[model samples]
Each structure stands twice: as C-alpha cells, then as structure tokens.
Target: MGNNFKMIAKTLFGFEELLAKELRNLGAGNVKEGVRNVAFEGDLGFMYKANLCLRTAIKIIKPIQSFPVRNENDLYRKIYHMDWFEYLSVDTTFAIDATVKSDNFSHSLYVSQKTKDAIVDKFRDTDGKRPNVDVKHPDLRINVHIHKETCNVSLDSSGSSLHHRGYRISTNIAPINEVLAAGLLLLSGWDGQCDFLDPMCGSGTMLTEAAMIACNIPANINRKGFAFEKWTDFDEALYEKIIAASLKKTREFHHMIIGMDKAPSAIRKAQENIDNANLTDYITLKRANFFKTTKETEGPLHMVFNPPYGERLDRSDLDSDFDVEEFYANIGDTLKQEYPGTNAWFITSNLHALKFVGLRPSRKIKVFNSHLESRLVKYEMYEGSKKAKFQKS
Candidate 1:
C-alpha cells in the first residue's frame, strides 16, 4: 500500500453519519464526521474507490495547504509560498471554487481571486509561464474554504458533483437529486431483501439509485470521469484494479424492482435512464396511477417514492388541476387500503400537505431537498387484522 493521506468527503445535510459509515465500511482509516463532511485517511487507491462507491459523497477533496490569514495579502503570501508546480503544469487549465464563512473575509470571489493570483504569480516567477484558468472545464479544480480566519486549500477529486451519476440522461420537471435519492434509500434500509417499488418514479432517479444500491453496484460505474483522472499522480492501473475488486463484491439481487408513473412521458424517460444504467433486466417500468394500483407481488414489499408535494407551483409534474390535500389523502388511503404487509417511505417539502395524509408516519426524518426543508416519512401497513403502526403525537 502507498503512504496514506487525509481526504475529506463532502456530503449534503443530514447525511454526515451515512457518509461516515460508508467510509468506515470501505476500510478508510481515522474516519471522523464533521458538519456535512467526513474526514478520513486512505491511500490514493482508496480515494478512487470512495468516489466510485460512495453514494452520499458529493465530492472528495485532498487538502494541500492550511494556514491562518487575517487579510488578502496574508492569504496571497501563504498561497504563493506553496509548491504549485507539484499539482499544476503550464499546459494544464485550472479553476477555483471558494466558500467563505468568516467575518474577516466577506467575499468568496475575492478570496478565490487572491488565491488564483498567488498561484499564477508563483508559476510565472518560477517557470515564466502560468496555467490558464478554465472555469467551465478545468483540468484541475481547486477548492478554498475559509472559516473564521482559517484558510484551507484543497484539490477537488470529483470534477462535477457526484450526483451526476451519468445514467440519468432523461429527466422530468422537479427530478430528485441523485445523492438525496440514494441517501433516502439507504435510510429506508432497502437492502434488496424483498420486492421494491417506486410509485411515482419521475424520471426514474430514485429507481436507478435503488437498483444500484440493491445490486451492490458502484454508484459511479456509469459516470464518465472524475477530476482525479487529471491529477499528476493518478495511477491508472491502480484505479482499474480498484474497479475490478469492487465489481467482484457485487452481490446478486433476486427480487423484482418496479417503477410506476401516471405520465406516459415519465415512464418513457424513466425507461431511458434505466436502460442507460443498463438496469432494464432488474427493473420493470409501468405507466399507472399509484392510487389505482395494488400490490402485485406476494412477499413483503419495500416501497420508496417521491410524491408531488404541491411545493413548486409551476412544476409540470403537478397536474394542471392538482389538489394538494386531496392527493395526500388519496396516497394515505391507497397505502393503507391496498399495500398490506408493506413499508412505504416518501419525502416531501410540503408540511401542510403532509398533515393531510391521514395516518401518522411511524418515522419522520428531517432532511432537505435543495433549499426546501423536507421530511422522509415512513408508514408500515400490517397484514391481516394487525393494526398498522402509526406515530404518536
């Protein structure tokens, strides 16, 4: 094994624990959780594996330098002193993404500019030529985060957000984010142990993520590339070995995975995405109203979906004649009456509409969908005459 180094895997809100657990399971050392991020120690190969397998991590960054800076000149001086040639070349293009949470530095753009100037000046002084900045498609992506006078500079290992799983070529209005979908699936404990269904599988993001989780497939197996591929120290043979090892660990999924949507267009788009993921054999797509369907399989069913919350007034997914309360009531009614011996989980940002679901949720987990605070609620429907478990007020 190569020398171990520290890396930070960034995640969304309410997903720190999940990312930490995932890191630990992947044999990461010195795993520690922070606000919306997890720190860990691993060799370069493990970094590749983390980007490929971790469902919740938005980006994995390798910190190159950290220092205290009270002013822009101090920041520039600290950055200029670093060995920029170790990471970037005169031919390489780069970009900076900065985040500031400090009273000392109020503008992130200025911080980014200062950092860029420092790096470029150092290169021009040493080699007489500096790498050009390409904000759109950078050969190397850098991250600068300042928190209360502390500045941390890191290299972004993932170029685009990890949510771009590459399989979702088609999408409907208000499609769920891929990371949120996978996290919700993991939270719901959908282990491919039983039959699975997504009632309102718009654009099939959730369904694709669920299928990958159930099959133990690498989340980014279909992704085009990572920023690490552009790194000077990247090892292609090592990454290939890691990919092969991960593929060897993929277990077989025996049960059926079903996705249903009322819109035929949604069904078509979902099918395209599923096919793009090459998961057609494992998932079945249907165009049917969720409220009109009943359980088709005999075994215990694991249902996870994202129903319309009437939160986005202009969303096309919302029927032209949508009724929020009545729709939620119908969802509650359908699950209670039709899906016996089942566990149904859904996320919604509409608190008012959620209240109209009639049955109290057994579990209401706090989560966020973009800027909207949301809840992932669970309802357990018992078989026969057993009472369904409901949450108490």
Candidate 2:
C-alpha cells in the first residue's frame, strides 16, 4: 500500500482477459478488462514487475491527468497548465505519442504536435528554456489518448514495444513477433506440463516462449531496459531486488521443448536466438521439413507454430511452384497421419489457404498478426482414433 495508482496494460486484440489475469497473478488490485487493454492498480515496484514479467502486454502507461476537451485549443490549454516540472526537466529530452478516437481530434499527429508545443511553451515561459523533442530516443515519453470527449494523458512506462526481448540477434524473413508468440502459447493452454513442439518454427519464437513459460521465467528477463528506468523517481536498488525475486521464482522444467524448420538458414538463426536467451539448454532445434517428421516424443504433446502465411516467408522459401492449397493440405495429412495425442495449433491470415487444411479446427480464436486479421486454429489429434474424436465432437 505504497502510493498505489491505476495503470493500463495495452495488448493485442483479444488478449485483454489474458493480460488481466496476468495482472491479478502479479498482485495487481482492482483488475478490469477493456478492449485490447487491461486496467489495474499497483505501486511503483509493481510497475517494474509488470514491465519485467507481463507476457501479453505490449506497453504499460501510467495516467497522470484526464479531462474533457472539445478542440485542440482545449487540449493545449489543459496541457499547458499542468506542472510539468515534476516529471520532466529542461535538460531532459521528451516525446509525445498520441492516439485519437474522436471526431474532434482528426489526426493523432496533430494532437501530438499540439501537446509538444504546449509543454515546450510552458517551460520556455517559466524557466527561459525548453526541453528538446526526440522521437527515436527520449528521456520522457508522454502518451495522449482521447476517446470521444475525454482526453487522458499518461507516461509511457515501457519505451519500445516489450516484444523486443533483446534475445533475437538474428531472425528469418518471416519471424513471428515475440509477444504474439507468447500470447498464442498462453491461449493454446500451454502451461509447460507436456512436451512442446513448433513444427514450422521459422525463428523459434514459440519454442523460446514455451521454454520460458515452462521454466516460470519472467517474459522480459532478457530485455535490456524499461522506460521507467529513465524516470526521475527510478530506484535502482528496488529494481535489482525485483529482478532477483522474479528469477528466484523460476522453477525447474522437466519437459522437452523442440523447434523444427525446413530451411537451414532458419535453424541457424533460431540457434543464435536460443543461445542469446540462454535457453539452449532447454530448447532443441533441428532443420527438417515438418511434413516429413513424426511425433518423436512420448506422452501428450503441445504444439503451436506460425506456418508460412503465403506472404512474409523468405523468397527462397517460396521460389518453387509453392501451391498454397496443397501446402496446407499436406499439413493436415501429416498431423492426422503422424502426430497423435497432440493439441496442435497454428495461426494464419490466409483464410482461403486455411480451408485447404481439410480438418476443421476444434477452436478458432480471432486474432491479429500485426495488421492482418488472423485466426489461431486448433486441431486436436486424439491419442485414440475416430471413435474418441466422434464422441468428443
């Protein structure tokens, strides 16, 4: 109970509940879900923990002020009167990031410009100097979010997208996003109980995330830094303590995690990334066509992968005749014929090609892969045969 404040953890579409659950598990109070975001209550130490451990969150923002605004002038007037000295100094570089969902504020860029102007003007009049604006790298990143008539201004606690986990030194052309990979694993009910596989694991994102989940490691443990570290009130000793505590909670994972790719280059990149994450001990990578492989492990298997979506794969990968339909059909054939007792899930935006997989998905969850509207489809290969599936279905 040390100066608790409300904060918003933003995420991809359809991940609000997951983020909310993560917050509650992390001891956040008053947890609530919103569209693509979750609001919760926590103090500064908890903020550090959230940034370090939240697997589904992209960015967390701490709201500093809120008010009603009709036009840009109202925004400027309101922003100018705030006591900026508390959070920012004349020597500190800052940036404004604005998102508007209102008819009053037509363009977000305009809103950002106006807010920057107000803040700089305030400093110029008061202290006879102004902080410079740095978009790429800034000491203080301000966030302005407007919905209808109310404007909410906040501090961006996570600078870049938390998906930059600092371990991906090399990647394939169609590398899956780290945050999306982690969320997909969570949604697939992958709790690291059984053996895990990513058959078409291009850059081994799913494999790495699976190992982290299995080991109970912090999601961003490999991440270099968070924005809060640059804040004026950042406590270095407290952050170190939090890191040590999180690492202490990590438990031993007994199950195997595997990644397979057809391309040699992909295997090489995945090996580099896994090594960078210090997960080479927990993950195994092989260069093999997934359709040619069978279930090599015993017991139930958890499989999640991002297959070639017909768009982003390397040119060499798609240089052949590359029949999209037959490619997916082979996927179904292999899964149905080879792998059993596996809860196999994969995401794709190519709906037309997805239908060619033949087998109907047991669960289809709508999601977004960056800008593409995608579906994370699950096809459960029963340990038993047609009788068991028919009864369950």
Candidate 3:
C-alpha cells in the first residue's frame, strides 16, 4: 500500500459499518469507521473502484490539508498558504462545500466564503487570474470541514451523491434513496441466494438494487460521472482498466427478482426504471396488490420493500380503502396466511402503526429514510411442518 492515499467515504447515519466493510472487502488499507463516514487508504485506481462499488457510500472525498484555526482570519491565512497550484488553476471552475460544528464558526456559508476567498486570493497573487466559482457544475469541488478548533480540507471525489445511479428516470410518490435501498438489502442478508421480492415496489429501487447485489455488479456502474474525472491528475487509461476489471467480476444471477405494485402507474414507472437500469431480464414487474398475491416461487423467498406508511402515501390513493392501522394489520395477515416460507422485511416511519401488524419481528434495525427516523423490521414465515416463533416488540 505504498502508493496508497487516504480517502473518506461518506454515508448516512447507521450505514458506516456497511461502508467500512465494503471498503475492506475491496482491499482498502487502514479502514476506519467514523460518524456517517468511513476513512480508508487506497490508490487512485482503488479510489475509482471504491466509488464504483461502495453501495452504501453517499460520496467519496480526499482530504488534502488539516490545520488549527482560531478564527476566520486564521482559517483564510492557513488556506491561502497551502499549495493550491497543485490542485487548482485559474482555468478551473471550483466550489466550496463547508460543514461547521464549532463555537468558533457558527455559519457554514461564511466558512465556505472565507475558504473560497483564500484559494482565489492565492491564485490571484501568483497568476494573473483566479478560478471562477461554479456551484452546480464545478470542475473541482472542495470540502471545508471545521470541527471546533480544527479544520480539514478535502476534494470531493464524487461530484454528486451516489444515490444518483443514473438509472430510475421515473419515480413514484415516495421513492427510496438508492443508497438507503442498497443498505437495507445488505442488512437483510439478501445475498441473492434465493428468489427476491419487493411487494410494494415503488419505482422498483429495492428490486434493482437487489439484482445488482446478487450479480455483484458495481453500485455506480450507471453513474453519470465522478468529480475525479475533472481533476488535474486523472488517469483515463487506469480508470478504463478499473471499469473493465469491475465489470468482468459480475456473476450470473439465476434466481427470480420480482416486484409487485397495485397501482398501474407505479407498475409502469417501475418497469421504466427496470428497463433504464438494463435489468428487465433479471427482474419482473406486476400490477397486483400484495395481499392478494401468494409466494410464486417454490424455495425460500427473500423480501425487502418500503411500504406506504400513511406518512407519505395517502391512504385514499391505495387500492384498499383501509386506514393505516388496518393496512398494517392486513400486511401482517397476508404475510402470515398467504406468503409462507418467506423472509419478509419492510421499513415504516409510522411507529404507532407498527404495533397493529400483530406479528413480531424476528429482527429490527434502526435506520433513517431521509429525515424520518425509521425501523427496518424483519419477519420470518415458517416452512413445511416447522413452526417459527417470534418475540413481540
């Protein structure tokens, strides 16, 4: 790992462990899990691979400098004194994203302004011009993080959140974030071993992510572009090699991946997204209420989905004219009576409605679906003559 440099993969809350494990599995050195982020060491190629493969990572950043700062002036002076010529030029367009958690710096925007001023001032002093600030489509996106008295500066390797997987041109009312979808599948132990189903498959995100995981495909294979592509030292040939190598590792997935939604519009949207992902062959979409359908496959089935919890999806819009509590009860009844020999999992932000399910969850994990605090609960339905016992939550 002599040629390795440290990189940070930012993730959502409760997904740090998954991202760190992914980094280690991808042959990262010195992997460490942080709050909503993971720090690891890898070379340029590995960095690219990490961006392409890390399912739970939101963004990847490369820190360039760390220093102590007493105030805004100290921050500007320290940033100005750095060798900005190595990373940026007058011809490059740049943007600064700041995060401040300190009494010294209360406003993150002000910190970003100071950091930008310092970098531009440095360029102006040496060269005759300075880089222009382009927040939307910057050639280089710099990160400024102030933690109390210390400041850390980094380059954003990922231009946007990894959730923009370049697929899913269509979405339903409440589409789940791609990273959160992938993380939920991983946490459910959905290794593509058996048939998979996302019963309330809104936009087919869970199904798409499940198929990708089953085939070991790179997470960001459909991404538009990374920030590193616009960097000064990007190696095009090495990146091409990395892409080829990652694609070559994809394995065959024989098990069926199924998605069902009652609404015809959602079904159409899901199909469009599945087609966009080029995964129409691996996944099948149907317009049917989950309560009316039974397990189609013979073997043990794996299920993961984000159902309408009455919080996002209005109850009247659903096919059934049942209230939220009644809807949850029906879900519990369906899984218990119709879908036997299946491991079902779903996330719901409606905490009160959870108790109406009546079925105890085999496992429960605390996760966040956007700003709403949610719980991903698992229920294992028994097979054959065996009886499955579960503890009530």
Estimate candidate 1's alpha-carbon lDDT, on a 0 to 1 scale. Answer: 0.92
Number of backbone collisions per candidate, in order?
0, 0, 0
In candidate 1, which residue ranges exceed 4 Å CA deviation?
313-317, 388-393
- Per-residue lDDT over 151-220 for candidate 2, one digit per residue giving the tens place of the 0 to 100 score: 9999999999999988999987767889999999999999989999999888778899999999989999
The TM-score between candidate 3 and the true structure equals 0.97
- lDDT for each candidate structure: 0.92, 0.91, 0.91
Per-residue alpha-carbon lDDT of model 1 for 101-153, expressed as tens digits?
99999999999999899999999999999999999889999999999989999
Better of 2 and 3 by TM-score: 3
Clashing pairs in 1: none
Lowest summed lDDT across 10 adjacent residues in model 2 is found at 384-393
> Per-residue lDDT tens digits of candidate 3, residues 1-393?
588899999999999999989998999999999999999999999989999999999999999999999899999999999998998889999999999999998999999999999999999888978999999999999999999999999999999998999888998787899999999999999998899999999789999999999999999899889999999999999999999999999999989999999889989998898898889899998899998988889989999989865566765656665677788988898888788889999999988999988888878899998898999999989975543464334
Off by over 4 Å in 3: 313-322, 385-393
Per-model TM-score on C-alpha atoms? 0.97, 0.96, 0.97
* Model 2 misplacement above 4 A: 312-317, 387-393
